[model samples]
Each structure stands twice: as C-alpha cells, then as structure tokens.
Target: MRRCGPAAYPQPIRRCASCADGDRSLRTVTGIFLALGIGAATGLGLTAASVGRGTGAGVLHIGPWLATPKAGTTEADPYARAVTARLGTLPLALADGLALTAEADDGGQRLDGRCTYRVSGQMPPARFWTLGVVGEDYEPAAPAGQRRAFTSYEVLRQADLPIDVVIAATARPGNWLPSGGAAQIRLILRLYDTPIATTISTSTGLPAITRVACS
Candidate 1:
C-alpha cells in the first residue's frame, strides 16, 4: 500500500485553507464597514456646514451682510427651502416683505456677543422695517417677557441722520438691542412691502455694521 504521506494531512490542509478564506472574508467585511462609516461622517459634516452657512444660489451681499431675496417665495432654491424647513420658521413671501441677515461687521469679522456693534446707514424705503438680534436659526434670542424684537417704530433714531442702532450686551443710548451675552449673534432686517427684493441690484441704500468695542 502507498504511504500517502502528503495526502495523509488532507484534513489539516483543508482546515488551514478554510481558516485563510475566513480571515479574508472578515477583512473584506471590515473594510466595507469602514468605508461606510467614513462616508456617513463626511456627509453629516457637509450638511451641518451647509445649514449654518446661510447661503443659496440667490444670495445678495451688501458689504459683509447677506440676504436671500427669494428665500421665502416659491422661487426659493432647494437649499433655502430645506434650511427654512429645518429651522421650523415660516418665511414671508416676496409679495409681503424682504429679509436680510448679517452675522459679521463691515470689516468682515464675525459678530461677537462680547463686543459692541453699531449698525448704521440708509435703508431702502419700506412701509415697515424691523431690526433685531436673532438666534443662529433666526429665532428670537431674547429673554421671555423682555424685548423680543425691535420694529422701525421702536428704534429711537437721530433726526436728520441715517439710521443708527447699537448692539451690545449692555444698554446704550439710541436704537439699542441687547446681545443677551451669547457667544455669537445674527442680525435680521425685514422690510415690509418693499421693492428691494426685486430691485436690490439698483438699490444703493443699505445698512452697514461697524464694530465699536469688545469686552
């Protein structure tokens, strides 16, 4: 009878091969999971960045301030609509009003609650206007029972001068809006029954924000 030396170890050899295949399969599964994890993390990061960026294809920039003229109308881009929906706030239609927001000063520095700012300049003609510090998502960021917002009638502007408003954690004379000691702030201006939503390109009168001091 043949010794069958090599074949005698057939069982062990087959086991070894099986083990090798199992290892490779495990590695493949791990690689697939890693790829999926990386893709998910990247996607989430992009979405978060897009939300706070406050921008869309129809963005309007005046100095460091920015606005989306069609953000509230049916003409709003997909990104704008998604953002508003996520914020759970309803935007007025173009026929009703135009809205603008500024998160930075004219010098292009992000507005800090620790610092004081002055918003001044000529504004477009509107039947009514309101200015105030809103939350990151444009929600009212004031203490309940306190001043929730400011309207054109509420601001005390200097006669014979352009509109000037002070934003600070502390109070100051003339058109003052408290910053509420938050880390960051955003300014929103709404113009009711204004043509600037469609005529911004030719509208020269716009507001400017100037950083005054910091704590």
Candidate 2:
C-alpha cells in the first residue's frame, strides 16, 4: 500500500470545517433576530411614553396653560382625539368655548394637593368663565366638604385689580378651591363665548398659579 499519512484523514478534516461553518451561520441568524426584537420593543415603549406625556403637535401655549383648539371638533387632531377618548371628558369646540388646563404652577412646579397655591391674574375677557380643580381622572375634587369649582360671577375681584383664588386641601379665606386630598391636581379654566379662541396668537391673559406652601 502507498504511504498514507495526514491525507488519509482528509474526510474527517472536511467534516469539521463544515460543522464550524454551520455554527457561524446559525449564530449570525440569531443575532439578527435579537436586534430586530430589541428595535421593535424600543419603538413601542417610546410611543406609549409620548402618548402618556400628552406632548402632541399643534398645541396652543397661553402663558403657563395649554390647550388644543381643535379638540372635540371635526378637525380634531389624532392626539386630541386620543386624549378625549382616554379621559372620557367632553372638550368645548373652538366656536362655542375653549378649555385651558394647567398641571404645573407658574414657577413650573408640579401641582400637588398637599401644597397650597394662589391663582391670580387678569381674567381673560369672556362672556362666562369657570375655574375648577379636578383630580387626575378629570372629576371634581371636593375636599372636606369644600367646593371644587368657582365661577367668574362668584369670585370676588377688586376693581382695577387682578382676581385671586386660593387652592388648598384646607379652608381658604377668599375664592377657596379644594384639592380633595388628591395626589395630583389639574386646574381647568373654561371660557364660554370668549374672543380669546379667535385670537390665539395674542396673549390670553390667563391666570397664574403660584405655589404658596406645602404641608
């Protein structure tokens, strides 16, 4: 027989090389799948966060307040529609009325029920207006048998002076609005038959909410 050495084992060596190539191909496929899965999850998470923050396009910023002019109307944006559906609350149309809401004080501090706030400023010109405190769920907040809302007709205003309304869990002296022991509070200022809706580019003269104290 001819002298056969390493060449006699050529078949075994070829089989090992094929096995290595197969393993590398499987690893590459697995890595691609993992990358795709991670990308999809990250995209979904960001979308949910944006919706929760309510930071949508075409929002009207009046001082420290925010409003969607097209909300609850035939021209409502997708974000406005989502918000209405989620909150299950009716929003006034631009023609009939406008609703402005604030979740933070004038100083950009988040409104907390444990803290007291003083809302004071020149009232926007309107036929009728109402200011109310509501919980996160948009329901009226009545704490300790206190009222949740105050109307422009009822709030005491001094001539040539701005209106002042106090928001607290306890009783306040003038224009008292209760927080109802809620962890978070939202101030809704609704203006009915207001010219402000027509001239949104101009300053709305909306009131400011200032934090006074926290217990």
Candidate 3:
C-alpha cells in the first residue's frame, strides 16, 4: 500500500482571476444603479415641495407686494393655473380688478401673529379697494366681529396723507384688524374697478407693512 503524505491531500479549489473580476464588476454596476435611483427620487421630492410652496416662475413684484399678472387671464402660466385650482378662489379678471399680496413686513421678516404691523400707504386712483389680513391658508384671519378688513370708503384718512391700518392679535387703538391667532399671516390688497395696468410697473403704488412690536 502506498503511504499517504501531506502532498497527497487534494489541493483547495481557488477562484480564477476572471471570475473575481466579474464579481467586482457586477457589484460596481449594482452600486451605480442604486445611486442613480436615489438621486432621481430626491430630485422629484424637491420639485414637488417647490410647487406646493407656489415658488413658480413669472411672478411680478411691485414694491413689497407680488402678483401673477396672468393669473386670471387666458395667458395664465402653468404655476398660476395650478395655484388657482388648488385654492379654489376666483381670481379677478384683469378688466375687473387687480389683486396684490404681501407676505413679509417692510423689514423683510415674515408677518407673524406674535408681531404687530402697520400697513400704511396711498393707493392710486380706483373706484374701490379693500385691504384684509388672511391666514396662510388664504382664509379670513378673524371672525366678522374682529374686523378683518378695511375698505377705502370706511377707512379714516387725512387730507393728502397715507392711510394707516394696524394688524395685531390683540385689540389696537385705531384701524385695528385682528390676526386670529394665526402664527403666520398674509395681506391682500384688492383694487376693484381700477385702471392700473395688468403689468406691474415701478410707479404702481402698494402699501408698506412695517413691524411695530412683538409679544
């Protein structure tokens, strides 16, 4: 009988270089696909978020107020159309009215319920105009008893002086409009039967919102 030595044991099977390289290549390909998929998902999420916030193109800025000139017209952009659809609010046609909105105070800080603001300015010629405080949801910030709006006909103004309206969560002494406990607020200035052009111009007069105090 032949004596069995260490060399007689079967040598362990070793992987070929080609097979090892193929495995590494497959892993690299899988990693690339995963990275691409993650990137695509992140991009989609950011786009959706921007649209929801109304960060659309083609916005017109007149002073501190902003409006989409084509919002209520046949030439409305996709973002304007989407906003109108989502809010379900009827935008005034160019011929009937002009609506301007402000979300920040003159200091460039967001309008907050915790702060009092004074909206003061002179409006251009218009048959009628109304200024009101609305919540972030575009609804009346306060109940009717709280006086949410001020109309040109009812507001007190001095000769050749700008009108002033105060907005606060609590009662103020003059021209008070309630904030309705909302953390964030927006101001809407609607001019009805106005001759102002649909396009915003530097001469367009809009109100200035100045922060007075905060709680």
Native-vs-model 2 lDDT? Answer: 0.82
TM-score of each: 0.79, 0.80, 0.77
With candidate 3 superimposed using the best TM-score fit, by how many Å does residue 162's alpha carbon deviate from the native? Answer: 1.8
* lDDT at 180, model 2: 78
Model 2: per-residue Cα lDDT over 57-148, one tens digit each? 65676656888888857888877777677668788978788888888888888889889999998887888899999888888877546687
TM-score of 1: 0.79
Native RMSD of candidate 3 (Å): 3.6
lDDT of 3 at 87: 62
Candidate 3 regions with alpha-carbon error over 4 angstroms: 1-45, 52-54
Q: Give per-residue CA lDDT, model 1, range 101-131, as digits (tens).
A: 7888989898887789888888788889998
Q: How many clashes would you count in candidate 2? A: 0
Where in model 2 is the C-alpha error above 4 Å?
1-40
- The residue-by-residue lDDT of candidate 3 on 102-141, one tens digit each, is 8888777888977899998888677899998898788999
